[model samples]
Target: MLRYVIDVVEMLDTPKTSGASLAEFLRSQGAENAEIMVKTIEGEEGLSTDFVRVFIPGSRGKSSGGSAPTLGIIGRLGGAGARPERIGFVSDGDGCAAALSAAAKLLNMSAQGDVLPGDVIITTHVTGWAPTEPHDPVPFMGSPVDMETMNDFEVEAEMDAIVSIDTTKGNRTINHRGIAISPTVKSGYILRPSEDLVSVTETVTGVNAVVFPLATQDITPYGNDLHHVNSILQPAVATDAPVVGVAITTAVPVAGCATGASHATDIELASRFAIETAKYFGAGQISFYDADQFAHLVSLYGEATHLQTLGRTK
Candidate 1:
């Protein structure tokens, strides 16, 4: 995990990194059995970015004819770098780095006999010249595309549950210098943390679980007039399947575009956690949320799908 993190960070700490380059790197790392796709998407004001999607199939996973659940691992980030403004890989790139590292590790495992039981879909964007935006405590690395465009590309229909990993250090939410997770979010409802997921976190980190603070606005669609902690939970707005956020955090607020602030060990920790989660989640050993309770919530109250949209005009 650490090796992959170091390699990815080194590769991405450039002004020429693109999705195609990262896809090639994965292929070189024994991804022959996986289905990988790279698309260059252009959004807002001629801004363009590369998106990479990798599907690592499980023996009994949906990619085949089996019925095992598929887990989506998304390296949710605004951009990997600020380019001319900031010269190196920013803190925001941690999510993409950790996620791609997990994909690489899984490919290595597949090269051996450690195949999982379910399919895993991993996606993230690569952008080196993203812009910056002013925020409260620190500035954010703005993406080349909007949240909706990211959702369209990264959020796959085959994903039964999603683990959205993003750098959550730009806010004063969780004051930890490691990884934290958000509760299971589905259909606009912020459910409790999955005990199974929490256990996985504990097993990987060898420490108590740290839950990232979240608000309703955080899970809502971006572009709305609301204060989101960050885009960590934005994937929830794009899928009915339960989504959990794995946040790379810091004890103090840090700008998303801040250079020389990324910790490979922490990113490696998050990568290990995601890989373990995929192993357990694909085997049907755990769930993202309680199905019965979620049904009851829907039965007790109507759908909160409205919260997923931008809502009616003011």
Candidate 2:
């Protein structure tokens, strides 16, 4: 995984990185059965980015007529680089790097006959020249496309559970220089953190697991004129399946658009954590949230799906 992490970060650090190039790299890695799709979309500002999706079939995966749940590993970020404003790959790109590195490792493993039980889909965008925007405390990277566009390509209906990786160093909270996990977010409900996932994190990092604070607004859809920690949990707004955020953190606040802020070892740890979760989850060994508890909450209260929308206009 360390090797894969290093390779991926190096590949993304360049301003010439694109979806087709990444897709070509992944195709050459292995996973002959994997379905890889690359789409290039031009933004309103005339800037275009590529979206890459890799689906690795498992031994008992649905693609092969098995009932095992499919696990999605999504790399959520505004862009990898903020060109004209900042050079090189930005810190926000770490999430994409980790996710793609995990995909590469899985592909290699599958080629060597180490397939998991269920299917795994990894998706992310390649934006080498993204825009920058103003945020509280620090500046942030703006995507070439809108959040809905990102969700349309990355969030798949086949995913039973999703692990969203993002750089959350722009905030003052969770002042640690490692990886942190956000509580489970499901259909507008911020459920408690999954113990199985925490165990995975602790085991991977060889330290106590770090859980970050999840505000209500964080789970809502973007463009609602609300402050979100970032788009780490944005997938939850597009699906009913449980979603968890794997955040790359820092000991102090750092801008997402800042260059030379990514830590290779930290990225590896996050990638390992995502891989572990995908393994156990696909094998039906872990649960993101208590199903019965979620049912109870919904039965006691009501549907929280409205939060997934822009809300009643006016």
* Best-matching candidate per lDDT: 2
C-alpha lDDT of candidate 2 relative to the true structure: 0.93
Model 2 lDDT tens row, 173-276: 88899999999999889999999999999999999999999999899999999999999999999999999999999989999999999999999998999899
What Cα-based lDDT does every candidate model obtain? Answer: 0.91, 0.93
Against the true structure, candidate 1 has what lDDT? 0.91
Root mean square deviation (Cα) for candidate 1: 0.9
| Model 1 lowest lDDT segment of ten | 27-36
lDDT of 1 by residue, 122-171 (tens): 99999998999998889998998998999999998889999999998988
Residue 191, candidate 2: Cα error in Å is 0.4
